[model samples]
Target: MSQDERPALEDLLGAKHRWYHVVDLAPGVTTPGWIDLRPHVGGPQLPASLQGQRALDVGTFDGFWAFELERRGAEVIGIDVDQIPPPDTPQSRWAEVQAELDGAVPGTGFELLRRWFGSSAERRSVNVYELTPEAVGGPVDLVFIGAMLLHLRDPVRALEQARAVLRPGGRLVLFEPIDRKLSKRSEPLARLMIGSTIWTWWYANRACLTDWVKAAGFTDVEDLGTRDVVDSTGNKQRHLTLHARA
Candidate 1:
């Protein structure tokens, strides 16, 4: 496309669809995403280069991390469910949560950005619980899950499913929300956020998150520490990052 024919970033941002990850579609033309992960691209949270690797991105909203992995030379496949699941709360809250998610199509922004970036990375409609070698073509060398565990009713099971699709001794990198107050304690702890309107189920401490990884059968677990990031809405959130081997 010629410069004169290029779509304005502001016009794309004004569209009805919601984008979850900030992505640079072109020079100075970036998507207005809820979470801007551009800063952490080459950081310790992710491999500096995924040259000659096969990677799976769980909950790949808007394809930011998946595209980054592809940019680093990995053959990437991103997976997400067609419908958003309700939080692990009372039955009374299901209607309200479902109502909020109604009419919101999953993977629309991802498909749009994928086409814009000319990315060969594939996007699949697969739930985290259904992840497997057969489900995602074959085992991958690395599995990346970002900011997704908190929304799962069974995070540990999801982790195990993530593990199932990795080659033996493959890498597992995860980014998740952490409870600042709970993290101050040395013991494993988690705060139940069943009442969250956004469908967040748990806000676990770093230790608790580490334990969950270990319990999922990952080895060489390493907590890479925490960092604060601002969402598109200007809300500050602290997140914990971990790396492990399957």
Candidate 2:
């Protein structure tokens, strides 16, 4: 199919919002969020404010969730330290998402930017730490934290930043991947293809995350149900889509 004929991530969700996807890491071994993602379907569990609002896709891996959020009717601004594969590989998440049928997230649908994760150190972008309250410059009604949280050594700080980006009533949508002790040294093919290889997270329990949201100073925190993105092989990573207010 031609690129023009392809549907944008938001189109699939039945909306006309702008979409953004960000990924700041190298090729991954396992899908980050280190968990499974359910089929992209909407439900009442979604943030009530998602309709006709703005969203910031942090740590987007090929804009998957970013596009999904756009379809939900939120203007999206995608941000990432790196968009291209690490100097080590020449693949992207956009294409890898399709690899799911092969038990890997194909790279086509997930590819978006062209920078590396650590590159932020030597060179930084003004937009990196830039933010205005959601109510002011279109404060994000919701922020999607796909697999991005795991890679962050200090996820709490990131969460705080996300809170700052949102308005008082805005929500942070998270698909956090708790840490795991995989038996295999690595899933070579999946790593090479989806770039989920070098991923990590704290492997927090539901209760732990609930507490975390509160600790981050969010007034109301609720579970939006966990999602499992299953691959062709039947192996799945477990993840929860959380809804927390600023």
lDDT of 2 by residue, 84-158 (tens): 222222244434423433432323324322121111111111122343453225566776676655454455666
Q: What is the lDDT of residue 221 in candidate 1?
A: 98
Candidate 1: residue 110 lDDT (0-100):
75
Q: List where candidate 2 sits over 4 angstroms from the true fold.
A: 1-40, 47-49, 83-138, 179-197, 232-234
The residue pairs in collision within model 1 are none
| TM value for model 2 | 0.56
Error of 1 at 243 (Å): 0.6
TM-score of 1: 0.90
lDDT of 1 by residue, 111-201 (tens): 7776666678899999898888999999999999988898888899999999999999999998888898999998999888876555777
lDDT, residue 158, candidate 1: 96
